[model samples]
Every structure is written in C-alpha cells, then in structure tokens.
Target: MATMEYNVFVGSETGLLKAANCAEEKWNNLNTLEDVKKDNEICCMCWGSSQQEKVYFAQRNQLIKVYNILSGEICEEIELNAGEGKFKNIAVFDQQILTALDSGIVNLWNNKGESELEIKTGDKLSCMRQNFFKRNLVATGGKENPLKLWDINKPTEPIFTSKNVPHDWLNLRVPIHVMSIGFIPKSEKIVTGTGYHQVRVYDPSTYQRRPVLNVTFDEYPITALTVCPNGNQVIVGNTQGNMTKIDLRKGNVACRYKGFAGGIKDLQCHPTLPYVASCSLDRFLRIHHMDLKHIMHKFYMKSRLNCLLLSKKWPTIDDEGGSPTDVSKEKIDDMSDALWDKLPVLGSKEQLPSGKMQKTKKRKLATKELPKQKMKKSVC
Candidate 1:
C-alpha cells in the first residue's frame, strides 16, 4: 500500500505555521489575520501556484485580495461590489477572477480590474462551480428554479439550462434551489445539492435529470458538495452540521459524521490526498480523513468558513527505474484483462428510504398548474 502523508497548515492569531504533527490543538495561536489586513468575516480562501511561490487568495465583503505565502505580503487587491452583497463566492481561474453576487449574477474580471463578463442568473445566484477538468465552463444555480451552464468564452448565452432538474430532495415541493454544484472531475456528470437535502447528478450532454441520489442530513438545505480526490466518493455538507459521504460507483452511503456544531457552509478536498476540509456557521474550520472512522484532525477558524481550497500536490516522476523492457507486453495485457473482469457495474436503483418520503416513481414538475395561452380572436 502507498503511504499517505498529512499536514495541517493554518493561519491563526500568532502567524502562519505548520502545526506540530498531529498536535494541532497544542499549537493554538498559530497566526493572525493581520497577515491579510482585514476586519474579519472572511468568506473564501484559496491557494494557487504562481511562478515558484504558492499564493493564497482571501475574499471579504468589499475586497478580493491575493497574498504571497512565501513572502506573507498582500500582493494584489481589487475592490469588489460586495457592499450590500457579501463576496459569497470566489473562484480563481488562470489570472481571471470569478465572483457570484447575492443579487443574482456572476461577474468575471481580469487581474488589471477590467470587467470581463457578467452572467445574469436566477433570483439568488447562491453558488457557482467550475468544471474540474475544464476551467472555462462554469455552472451556477440557486433559488432561480433553474441551473445555468456558461462557457467563459461566450458569456452571453448558456450552452445548457435546466429547471426543476431534480436538484433537490424528493420531499421538498418548492422550485429547485440549486444551493451548490460539484463536478465529478474527469467525468461529464456533475452533482448539485438542493434545498431538500437531496443531491442530483446529470449528464452535461443532455440537461435531463438522471440518477437522484437521496442524502440523509440532520437538516435541510445542503450547502456544499465535493468529490474526494480519488473520484470514487461524493460528500455533502448541510445546514444541520452533518457531512455525509456516499460511494458514487455503488450508490451507497459510505460514512456520515457531525462535522461541526452549526451548519456546514462549504467544503474542499485536498488536491492530492484523501483528506477533506470543511467550514461551518459554528465558526470552525475542520479537517477530516475520508474513511470509516472519519477522524476530526483539526479546527482552524473562528468565524463562519464560507469557502476553502487546498494546495494542489503535483505528482513527481520517479527517479528509480520503471518497469524493465524485459517485462513482456503480453503480461501487462493479461493483468489489465483480470482487473476489467472485476469492475463493478453502476446499474441499480438506490434502496428506497423508510421513514423518508416515498421514492417518487414519476418525476415532479416545477408547478402543477400550467400557464394558459390566450386564444387569439379568430380573424374571420
């Protein structure tokens, strides 16, 4: 088995420090917010690689700013239109910045403060997600009763759109409120968490609703959805302070745990490990391993953690010699054939819930009443 390493990097009242291995609780006062120059209420934090340094981005109500982790200095800052609306969502793409407005639009801007594009969306443009495999494509959905998919190159029109696409739980009778969206990494399917504690996966090729994965939460309004680095597990965090993990291939619950005292708002998986990080209204940033035990490793923040991003672990080529040329191609082919024979087929309807709402055999419509089309007066 490959040995996995875990590390906790936190910013606290003292300064940025790598917590003593497995002794996170002992290393209190790890750092302070003075490193970022903010009054607090930080909604998002992301680490990205620039040149040889790892840079971090932290967004508050009025500013989208960047910091060089190596130098511990704020490198760039741009004023965002987040006065009345909090900078609830922030995504860093190349040098371009994408932010979602509570006012129901997604704005893209360049590094030099030039507005790139704006996507007008539903009533509450609650969340926005980028494709893990393709950065240019983004999906946004919220109380609008519809999910919008837009390509960055063409912001005026969405390539795909769907309403009442089973984005919510079955018991919820309200219009689909797509609170969160997550991509399945390399796959075309993406899952969105909705208001009723339900998550739905759909094929991007066609906007039709497909497999409805009912998630059990301690409460309603699933706020975040994230796929583990392995791509085999899906996890969702809800308002009731529960983070449930499900096996995507098996369509079965893998594990469930109470992530925080208050509701969970956002979660991010380690870029290269099986670790998961989440933030909650309970004013805590917690990290856990995606396993049966679901060990709670560290609690880092004091205010509600609105968003998080782990540093990407780039893979390095082994200096040791690889497979020898003497290894026959026929032997490799034989091993591949054996593995294929044991692959599991994902073709079963999930077991119906017992106390929960009956599995609706027929798809639910947005509204029972269809609008009447007025009959034009006969010209004759």
Candidate 2:
C-alpha cells in the first residue's frame, strides 16, 4: 500500500510561498513558486476542499490564487468581490469557496468563479470561520462585535449571537475584538482569540448568549489560535510573544513554550503529530514540540511571515520503518561556527579574562623628525 504524504505550504510577508515534505527528524524545502511575488503580503491560506492536493492563497490586494502542491502548477486564479478591502479567510468545500473580507462581507464562489451568495456580517470584522463538521454553519466576530453564527443557506439572519459579559468592577462595558476564530471539532462549540487577551468558547445549542468558557491570558492581544488534535485544548499566541497551551476542559494554562522574538502572526499544529509551528513579524519560522519548552528548528525566512498551511498528508516510510529524509548531515555541514564567532553579539556584554587586568595602549607620533621634501629645479 502506498503511504499517504502531506506537504507544508507557507506564505510570507512578501508573498513568497514554499512547500516542504516534513519528517520526524528532517524536512526538505521544495522549489519556490513564481506566482506569488515578493512585493505583496499574504493574507491567509488553506487546503482546498474536496482534495488535499490543492491549496488556495489570498493576498492583501484581494487576489486569490490556487496551486497544485504535488505538481507545483497553477490550478486557477479568481478575483475577490469588487471594492478593494483586505482579504481575510478562505474556506473551501466541494464546489464552493467562501472568502471573508475585512469589510464584514462573506462571499461564496462556485467552481466556475461566479459569485453565488453574499452574507453581511458586521463592521470591524477581524475573523470568520466555517464549521468543521457543519459546512453550512459559520462564525464571525470582531471589534465591539459579539460572536455570531450564520447559515449559508439562509443569508438573512444569524442563528445565534453571544451576549457580552457583565461590566467590569468599574462599570465600564468590556470591548470585543476577536482576532481569530475556529470551530471546535467533535462538538457544537466555537473558540475565539480576542484583542482583549482572552480565549473564549461559545456554544450556540443553548439559549444563553454568554460564552460557555472564558479564560484570560497575557495582557497583550491574542492574534491567532488553533485547536489541538485532542479537541480539548487550543494553542494560542499573543502579540507580546507569548504562546501557551490552554486546557479547554479545565480552563487553565497548560504549558508555555518559548522562542518567539517578534509578535506572532500565525500558529498551526502538525496534522497528526505532537509539534507546533509558528510564523511571525520577526521574519522567522519556528517549530517546537508541544511537550518541550525549547525550539526544534528556527529559520530566518528573509521576509515577515503572515500565515502558514501544514498539509494533512505525510510521507510514507520505507519498509524498514524509518523515514528516508534526514537533514542532520546537511544541517551540520551548513553550520559555520567560525563565521558566527566573528560576528558581533547583540545584547551581550564583553567579558574580561578572570583574575587578569589589561592595560590600554595609546598610539604616539614618531619622536624623530622626517626628512623634508627637496626643492624642484626651476631653470636649465
């Protein structure tokens, strides 16, 4: 039997896209695609619906491009709805493609690139998500906007709306700024990451609009969130470079991993592994094991990273039961210890030798006078 393989596709700040066949020990970066230029920013990306071989990428200019990962070919290109606005998320299923715009409008497009339906969410729309189990159900939220669920079939009204929590101790109404949203798997609830540094879960099956679960994290805004495979926890990243695992069942911080130097832009978990990957404004991509607080690999990507897509498919190992891909040898050869030693260390202090004092030397001009220049001959 041929083993299933999945490749990871990444989008950068300059719209540079890359694919990699990942393994437990090493991975290989595939050739770059000329379709995504180095001048535009990537808004979001996701695997295509109906097939895992294709992926769709949205840009800052409202242009969407589809690519075949295995063949590295351009499958199709479609323009978003008229009136330029920042691109949001794309949810692909069967013959339909749903795109969310920053203007709080969700557009449904057919395979032939025709707009079929449009849903008006609200203003300041920061995030939107299509239900994982129920394709027709979608969630939307943003600044000062409560969480809402809508049915794609009935574009007129939302099925449910979340009620804001009671005022704070000072009686000031709390604000809403949901930066990211996703549907909970194997359940009827949804999770959201907010600008208020909160991770909230909402269940619409009940009549109450208040969140079923609410937990506060760092003081900085939570920019991105992804559900763990177990469906009982979520990995959340904040603008203050804090990435933590929050247990949904217990409503407490599970583990706090380090490695983010700049603010995080996106966070994604491995398809069926215990690894987590992140891209950020620091122009670096970092991967770490969920159980380990240290980094596994860190790469300087030359451009700020906005979003990343990890394919569900992975390579089939050999009959010997070991993966063929190994980067250890190449990684060791690629390392330059001498080059690094010659470079200046940032944020580090110069240390003097132990139990030794060095005297400073000043340069002095020569005490002996030099010979003067001879006069030139004037006449013959």
Candidate 3:
C-alpha cells in the first residue's frame, strides 16, 4: 500500500471539503450549512494556497472567503463590491488579494478584509494574473482588444498598455472572451490564451504577438491554462477534456493525457512534480502524471466540480489500503466482508445510533469495475 500523492479539494453548491486517501476518495465535509447559507453559493472559484495554512475560495455572491484548511474554519471573508456586477476571478499576492470584477475593476484587499487599493480597467476584465516576477504589476484581458498592465503603486490607472498587436505568426484569430494573460516565468515575455484555442506568447518589450502555438479542438471552450513548474511546458485543458502539454522551446506537443469524463472546468499543475489535477461537470476529480502519461487516480464527488487545485504543501489523509493500481480481488472481497462484519459489533438493534432505523443484513457489494479506462483512452 502506497500513500496517496494527491489530496482533492472538493467544492459544490452546498459546501467544500478535502477528500482524502481511499480507493474512492470520501469527502471529509468541512463546510457547514450556516457557512453555505451566508455565502449563498459554494465557491465559484477556489485556489490552493502556496502558504500552508490557508485555502482561498470565492462565492458567486461577491465574497472572497479564505479558510484555514488545518482547522476547517473560515479565516477571512471579504465582501468584494467595487461598484456594480460580480467578480469573476480572484488572485492572491504576498499580503493581498486581487479580485477581478465584472465591472472591469480589480480590487485589492489585505488579509483583514480592508480595501487596500483598486485598479480600474476600462474594459470588462474577463481574466487576469499577477506578474511572475514583479508582484506590484498585474496583467488583464477581456472585452478590450489590448492586454493592459497595471501597477498597484500607481493605484489610479495602467502604467503601460499594449493593444491589437498583429497576430501574424502567433495566430491569435478569435475573440478575447475567457482569455488568460500570464507572464513567462522569469522573462519579460507574456502569454495569452485566446478563446479560440490559440496561445499567443508576447514579448512585452517588443510588443510582438507571436503565435506560440495554435491548439485545435472540437467545440469545447478552453476552460483552464497553466504553465509547467519548470517554465518550459505550457499545459492547457479544454472544455472537451483534452489536456495537452506543449514544449515552449520547440513549439511542439510533448504529449496528451485525458481523464475527466466531461469538459474540464479547471486544471491545476503541481508545483514540484509532473502531476496535474482536473475537474469537470462529470463530478469526478482526476489526477494525471504529465511524465508518466497515465491516469493516476479517480475520485467521485457529490456535485459538479467547479474548481481543482494542487500544491506541494496541502495536507493529505493516510490510508492502509493500497493505491488505485494495487487493489486486489481478494482485498476488495475482504473489505466487503468487513463492511458487513462490523454490523454485529453493535450490541442490539435498539443500541444503534439512529435507533428507530431498523437493522437488516447487509448485502454483498457489487463486483463490477467502472469502464472509465476505455473513456480515458478515447480522448487521449
């Protein structure tokens, strides 16, 4: 039996929890009813903290709720309302959180829930990200054709901006809807994910919109984009459940691995390993090793998975059972017996915790394994 390498962060309309080590990962159910009712909806977006103590989650109600994962309690909830509409995304910095709202305003707040500053974007901010090197600077893209860079210190408007740079070789041939803007790890070069499954890597210094790669898929929207930890591979997952790793240096596909049954809603890459996690409306959390090119584990959830995150520091649950591959027929049968054998341990029917619920002999569990293996291969 090996220790589970991944711990899934599950968030549904009702609540959220960290589902841990099991053949089928089970929810620990950390969110209480009161918390869900207060926020209206469970987090619309959730990000795993680089900091060990916190898990960042946001609700549709325009509230950014930060949780202390170790204690399973809310640490801070910031009501983010700039002027109008709702916030679509939130990114955390060293000591502040940057929230991109529907009104094209990015609000900055500290851990104590106080507004530190606000960056006003002239266009609806569909997507945004902090610079990889400079924390004060941020990049945004959306309804506007140009990708704008803002400085928090200025606090009034963008310090520098670039617009409609021709997408000659980079092939940026679509609307900016749901596009993503990110800077190359340590370089001044920046990259954007066009809604049309094309990735444009831009050299900010030269304002060149070079098509790094044009990733084609069926009709599925590009749901999520992440850069590899090594900063050489660009991993993009589309709504069609296709995860492709492209080598930035060679501008070629490294390999493709598919696991999510439905369109991917979110994609997260590990900080230290070649592993990534993706969630979809299919209600399953899937783990894949980018290097191994195989499905590592699959865990079912109660509702549509809106977000998926991976961090080297998030806590995990320990189990005695073997890893997903090592499970044997005999072990499963033994588990089935143990599930029933524990019933007699109850002194009497009246001694049951529910008491009124009558006790009946537990039936033997089913022996069918899921057909997900075939499904995983089809998309790959």
lDDT of 2: 0.76
The window of 10 residues in a row where model 3 has the poorest summed lDDT is: 361-370
In model 3, how many backbone clashes occur?
2
User: What's the TM-score of every candidate structure?
Assistant: 0.68, 0.78, 0.71
Identify the superior model by lDDT, candidate 1 or candidate 3.
Answer: 3
1 versus 2: better TM-score goes to: 2
Error of 2 at 241 (Å): 1.4
Global Cα RMSD, each model: 19.6, 12.5, 14.6
User: What is the per-residue lDDT of model 3 for residues 1-380, given as tens digits with 9 covering 90 to 100?
Assistant: 44333356655655554454434455455566565553455544545444555667777677777767566577777776556765566777766787877678788877667777777776666677777478777887776546777877786767556555455577865455546665677677666666667666666566344443444533555667788777777777776788788777877778888665677766777776556787777888787767766776677776776765565653332367443333334455787899998776666666666533432423211112235656688879
Candidate 2 — worst ten consecutive residues by lDDT sum?
359-368
**How far is 364's C-alpha from truth in model 3 (Å)?**
48
Stretches of candidate 1 off by over 4 Å are 1-40, 49-58, 81-84, 165-173, 207-218, 313-380
lDDT of 2 by residue, 166-214 (tens): 8999999888888988777888888999998989998888887888899
Stretches off by above 4 angstroms in model 3 are: 1-6, 15-24, 34-39, 42-49, 165-174, 207-219, 314-380
Q: What is the C-alpha lDDT of each candidate?
A: 0.62, 0.76, 0.65
Query: TM-score of predicted model 3?
Result: 0.71
Quality of model 1 by C-alpha lDDT = 0.62
Per-residue error (Å), model 3, residue 151: 2.3
